[model samples]
Target: MEKWKKDYLKGILRDYPKMEDYYLERKEKLLFHTKGTHPHSTTETQNKKMLISISLDRQLINLERNQKVIAQCLENATAETKEIIERLYLSDKQKASLDLVADQVFLSKRQVMRLRDHFFEELAEHLGI
Candidate 1:
């Protein structure tokens, strides 16, 4: 993959957890709408709700599709590949370098790099990027 495409996939991985959380919060807010009389007519309020629901549905579909792609890639990954993903991409802590990840996963740095590259390639293909 091109450098920019690789970086883009990495960026998506990095944001995955945050994106999930954000959408969940949004979903909650949508569900918790205040019940009160408003100046707007019933049709106008319903139309507004319908538009918001449509927008949220689109966002949720995209999120779920990406999540399914990621899940499939992870399902096919080796144990060591999972370790590399958890430590390097999925963790909430600061990102680990390839050297640190290799040490933690009991592999040489070069091997870690190779595994990571392979994993990214698979992920990119799954994502249709």
Candidate 2:
């Protein structure tokens, strides 16, 4: 993969967990706000709920769509490739660097870099990008 493509893929992986966290946080906020007692009138509360619901729904849809796309790409990949991608990105709160991934996978850092590049290449192809 080209350097830019590799960087792009890494950026997406880095952002994926953050986006998931944001979605969950917003969902919790929406539920909490809608259910909790407040000083607002019924009409005001209902309006607020409706707006929150719409915003949450849109965020949920986007998160789900992106997850599905990532899932599909992983599904099409070899087991090792999939594992490398997920371990480096989706399976943890903190993103793993290629060196850390190499250690985990028992490969040299350079080998891990190659795998990452190939993984992105395959993922981009699967995404038709």
Off by over 4 Å in 1: 28-52, 55-58
* Range of the 10 consecutive residues with the lowest summed lDDT in candidate 2: 32-41
Q: Write the per-residue lDDT of candidate 2 for residues 1-129, one digit (tens) a residue.
A: 567876777776766767778778867777666666454658677668757685758767666666677777777777777778888877764657778888888889887777777778776775556
Candidate 2 C-alpha error for residue 66, in Å: 2.4
Error in Å for residue 81 of model 1: 0.2
Tell me the whole-model lDDT of each prediction, alpha carbons only: 0.79, 0.72
lDDT of 1 by residue, 11-116 (tens): 8778776777867876665545422334365867765775577476766767777777888888899999988988998898866998899899999999998888
Worst 10-residue lDDT window, candidate 1: 30-39
